[model samples]
Target: MTVGFVMLCHTALDRAAQVARHWATHGCPVVVHVDKRVKRKGYDRLVQALGDLGNVRFSGRHACEWGTWGIVAATQEASSIMLREFPQVRHVYLASGSCLPLRPVAELVRYLDARPRVDFIESVTTEDVGWTIGGLNLERFTMRFPFSWRKHRRLFDGYVKLQRRIGLKRRIPAGIVPHLGSQWWCLTRQTLSAILDNPERAEIDRYFRRVWIPDESYFQTLVRQVSDQVESRSLTLSKFDFQGKPHIFYDDHLQILRRSDCFVARKIWPHADRLYASFLSDDPSAQATAEPNPGKIDRLFARAVERRTKGRAGLYMQSRHPNENWENGRTAAPYSVFEGFSDLFENFETWLGKATGTRVHGHLFAPDRVQFAGGDSVYNGALCDSAAMRDYNPKSFLTSLIWNTRGERQCFQFGPGDSQKLIYFMAADANAQISVISGAWAIPLFHSNRNFGDIRREAAQLQKIEAEFLTVLRASWVKARVRTWTLAEFIENPMEPLQTIVDEISPRSLRRLSEAPRLADLTGFGQFLQNLRNQGMQPVLMGDFPATGAMPQPGNRRGRPYLVK
Candidate 1:
């Protein structure tokens, strides 16, 4: 006995006609049900294309809408016609117009003939299914969904919520249990007839007419009641994304489709000339007698879904810009942010680049212009030094910098004088290593030849901004590695902190820091703080700086490091 095909065609009628003719010419009867939504001209053209084939026939048309009962009605009409007209057909394979036969038709016939009693349909209990998206699992059966989810989304959502609020549920038919799976299936003639001709079919049909996406569950659920031997899997290879949208096969997927060893694959691009020409050819390699195994390409599709959803870290694209905190990572790689370092040390960027052997950049968020290393107008990733563009989306700028310079480690300075927009974003990123010398902003203000009144006002502003930033770093939710020291404390022991920062950045290097960055002359800098305090603005973040501004000495290293012996 030969296998028959029942196809549901909507758009792309020409391609549908081609596939139907291929099946009919191969001695397999093809019964097709076209979506009534197709215009008459397109329908007539499809009919004319396949008119010469005697085995090809058309069933009654149905207005098939996705996520509705119309598709199931179309499939039922086509399958009934296949069983009635083609008496020689033993197995019926339900497919879509876009489905292409991957293996030779004769091979599929031989394979089905081996398991004549077994029905191949992906049937699984709702509780066992975890792949369902859109929050509908058992609710798909229990709750009545009269509104079309796609066409009338608001009404559909409102109805669902209304039903949920009232705790309304429908009782499933007594004899049958609801199951869900892929819409495509290949079933035995006996099983198909039993489901189509069941005495309570009208009642079951009425109940499922209001069911959400009955096309996927009607046959899948009913076959369990009638069929004794069920394989519980589809012979067709179809895959969906995390969003429940089917993955369309194109010319690039020819090798991938061949690797699946599936009997038929659906959702082929109509214009993929290469895929159509290659798969539809009479090549001997297409006649392999291997068992259908879709798992061979499961890993590939999983990665595709991951790439679409989570995406590559720090790489933002128009196709997917995930909501905040939903990204795979905030930045591509680990980098260092020096808060107040540049303000306290002269030529700090150059000193850091030499000491750590990594790219060191000047204040990236400076208001005037991005002070890139060596004062270049453009930097890596073609990023410009325009402060306006950088300020527009500071998060993207920083992420782009890290992503573009992935292999090489990056270090940049930050201060309250620069843009503070990325404060929260950097604080939440685990890749950020922020070493802060608090109250160091005062050092630049002290050195600046400005009016004392203006210095006092600016100091108050900078101190407030840095204090707020430090609060974020100390917050429990912060993911960045943060080390904060008062300006006075840092100068007292600069080597230890410098060594620690360098070790973390270049873990492979064992060399200790031999020389430190030149500290800016701090003569009377403490007096500057004292003067600010006298002016009624307490220099709290600076710790207790002495009036003389001399670097505080360690208290003689606890009795001059005497030997215990």
Candidate 2:
């Protein structure tokens, strides 16, 4: 008792003829059903191509639109012809035009023969169906879908909402539980005949005609009513992405398809000559004796889906830049943002890079141009010093920088003087390590040698921006590791905060910092704040500074080493 195939052909008639010939030559009956939308010439050509094979027959044509009932009617007509024309068939396998046999037909026949009574179909209840997309699960069966979802999407959506608002729901036929699954299935002859010849066939058909995408649920639900030995799984290997679109196999997926050991696979690229030639050839290789375990390649498909949807962390490519907050990560790796550090220290970027073995830069968001390390005009990933381009999408620029240089740690100086657009974004990112010394921006103004009036006004603006930025860092949603110290408090004992920051950046290094980045000459800097206040700009962020600024020493000194015995 050989198996029969019911092929639903729409596009790629030549490829369908090839697969039909392949199956017919292997002593399997094939019933081809072409979609009615195909032109007359293409239909006649397909008919003539397979005319020599007596085991192959053409079923009546039907206009099969996606997510519509015409496909189910076509499948039913083709399945009926398959059962009547082939008496020796014990199983009928439903396949699409794009399907190709991955294993020998004899192995599939043998596999079915071993399980003569079991039917292979993915039948699951709505509550258990986790893979259903389009937000219509139980509603698919309960509501009337008169409008085509593809051609009349607005009407379809509006009708669904109207039904929901009016509490309108159709009554399911008696003695049949609604089930959903992949449309492709392999059914035992007994089960297929029982479903086709059921006494209530007309009533069942009427109930399913208005059901949304009933082809997937028509046979899937009826077989449950007639057959007791259902396997609740399909023998065909098919995969869908997160959006419920099938993944088409190409030439490069030859090895991936072979590893599945599945008898048949669908949605193959017609242009994949290598895959067709390799699988369809009669090479004398050992027969695949393993069970049809598509799970072997499930991990590979899952990863493909993930890469398409979430993508690699911190990567902002043109192909798949996710919507805001939908990214897998804000940045690929952990990096440090030093606020006020540059203003308080001399050559702070160089000192931090040397201390933690990280790539350090100055005022990446500076107005004129990006201050890349060593003042280069260009950096990795072709990121240039174009302030206009960087300002256009600062978040993308930052994420691309981290993604391009992922293996190394990155440190950059940020201050109120730079763009504040990325403040909220960086504060929310878990990979950011921010160190802030409040009130340090005044140092640059103090030493600017500008008139006191201009310095006071600029200081007020910078102070306002910094205060708003600090509020965001202190927000509950901030995920980055943050440490904020007033200028006076930090200068009093700078080594402790410096040590903590370095340890976090390079946790594997166990050595304490032997020296610190040189502090800017803060002598009389306390007078700077007092001056701001006298000019009516209150500098409260700087913790109580002494009227006479005194630079705090490292506090303790290491004695000269003594030789041990």
Candidate 3:
């Protein structure tokens, strides 16, 4: 596994040369891009220092600027040079001049060899996390100003305010979801090639030219679109202070830097000669160990994982008719309801898995329908088959069993070998109320506007059905836990309800409840509620109480429904 370095540097020629020489010593090719703004003497110094390093080369200089397209342009130039000069390189790492190698270069190469397909990059949708300096706003993308805006800050600020006041904003291009991330990353050759070869490469470049801090988002957004191999985590260790500038490594931070799993650490001060000398020590043992033990950070990470997954209750949401076009009722152009749910569930499961080191299964009803966009099955033939649920290994992280409400009754039988802990999620929205009253049978006609009626009338009918259902559950002695939550609440902030549900259903002590009835053995819902109440547990309503305004009003369309098939 050949590794290449694309280092972008403007200052500290000596430090930049040291980084290049260090990596080159490990048989890695290094491509350096010195900012055009740097003095000619600085560039000459860098070249002279690295003249003996056969694997190191320099790209054409560009005037790199912070928080502008210039940084990305420099990166592209350096990466292109590396790809051309060293065609045998399998992976290219992007780093700044101040970044220092934290671990042995050989160890990093070995780690990459094992996970050849995974791209080490950090990324988040712009809408989800927003920009780093300030929260997300339209001004970042809409305002087109010169890079000199930094010099004439007041003028640029006033210009942006004026544009916003006049309602000037650029619409994000269709088929593109803006994403933002750290500028530093380690990418595979395939990912780099894909980014360079993207058909929309020119369009993307033009759009980002006016964006503030385009370097952070440009490669991140494009890489995500082109590669599913992304690991969503950067291999570089960088900590930002309150001002959002990266913390410069000092001698005091030696231990922390040495213990980190990251291959590199950033913003090393050029004047910290002692720190640099310590890092550049000739003795292998003086540097970071080849396989460093997990320190406090590892334990902290484990604790975080346990908090999210250990004993967490699974939430299963059921819809009568599943379709591809059922996202937040706004982005219904591409994804169906099933696709949207699958994506949400997959993200949730991924979060749990990463935190807990356990696999969380998503049991989607009629997998064939979801996969092929085929016809939906009314009955859940999968749930009725107990062997299928047993095979899911519920002892790990929670199982999110998604299916239509038709066969929900059969799901009561689902449990681990001896555990009876189960939580049923009931939607408290108007649409759910309508579904409960009309059942799946009337859904098609309802969607076609045939059975539509007054919102208050349908709501009242739904309340009656809910009361009756709860009454039946209370009387039946069921063993599983049941909770009511609205879709809006779940979508708005899932962590709150998820944590509550997990706390409710999780075992309170090390000792198992000997008298707890098995889920499959419970004859009615009453048995479960009674057993739960006997154990001092009460029924849970996981989300916020629905406001009266949340109730559906007359003439308000529920949502466009897609064919189940």
Q: Write the per-residue lDDT of candidate 2 for residues 1-565, one digit (tens) a residue.
A: 9999999999999999999999999999999999999999999999999999999999999999999999999989999999998999999999999999998888899899999989999999988999988889999999999999999999999999999999999999889799999999999999999999999999999999999999889999999988889998888999998989999999999988889888899899999998888878776273366788999999998898889877788876566564667788889999999999999989998888888888799999999999999999999999999999999999989988898888998899999999999999999999998888888998888788899999989989999999999888888888988888888778777777888888999999977988788988878878878888899999888777866665544345421211111
The Cα error of candidate 3 at residue 557, in Å, is 70
Per-residue lDDT of candidate 1, residues 1-565 (tens digit): 9999999998888888878887888899999888999999999999989889999889999999998999999988889999998999999999999999888888888899899999999999999998888989889999999898888999999999999999999998898788998999999999999999998999999999999999889999999999999898888999998988899999999889999999899899999888777777778575466889999999999999889888898787666564656788889999999998988899998988888798799999999999888889999999999999998888889999999999999899999898889998998998999988889999888889999999999999999999999888888888888888888778877888888889988899888988889999988888888899899998899877887766566453321111111
TM-score of each: 0.93, 0.94, 0.51
Query: Candidate 3's error at 242, in angstroms?
Result: 0.8
What TM-score number comes out for model 1? Answer: 0.93
Best by TM-score: 2
lDDT of 2 at 345: 89
The order of the candidates by lDDT, greatest first, is 2, 1, 3
Candidate achieving higher TM-score, 1 or 2: 2
Which whole-number lDDT from 0 to 100 does residue 524 have in model 1?
87
| RMSD, every candidate, angstroms | 3.9, 4.6, 22.1
lDDT by residue (1-565, candidate 3, tens digit) is: 6889999998888888887898898899999999999999889988999999899999988877777788888898889888888988888999999998877777788888988877888778766664377543445766775545567778767777787789887766666677778888999999998898778889878888888888877888788877888877788877665446676877776776777756788888888777677776656675654443324355543554444333222222133113322222211111111111222233433443333333333332222221111122322324332434533543111222232222221111111111222212121111111111112111121233332234223433433444455443344333223333333333444344344422332324222222211111112323333333354533232122232324222243332221110
Q: Given candidate 2, what's the lDDT at residue 289?
A: 61
Model 3 alpha-carbon miss at residue 171, Å: 3.3
Best by lDDT: 2
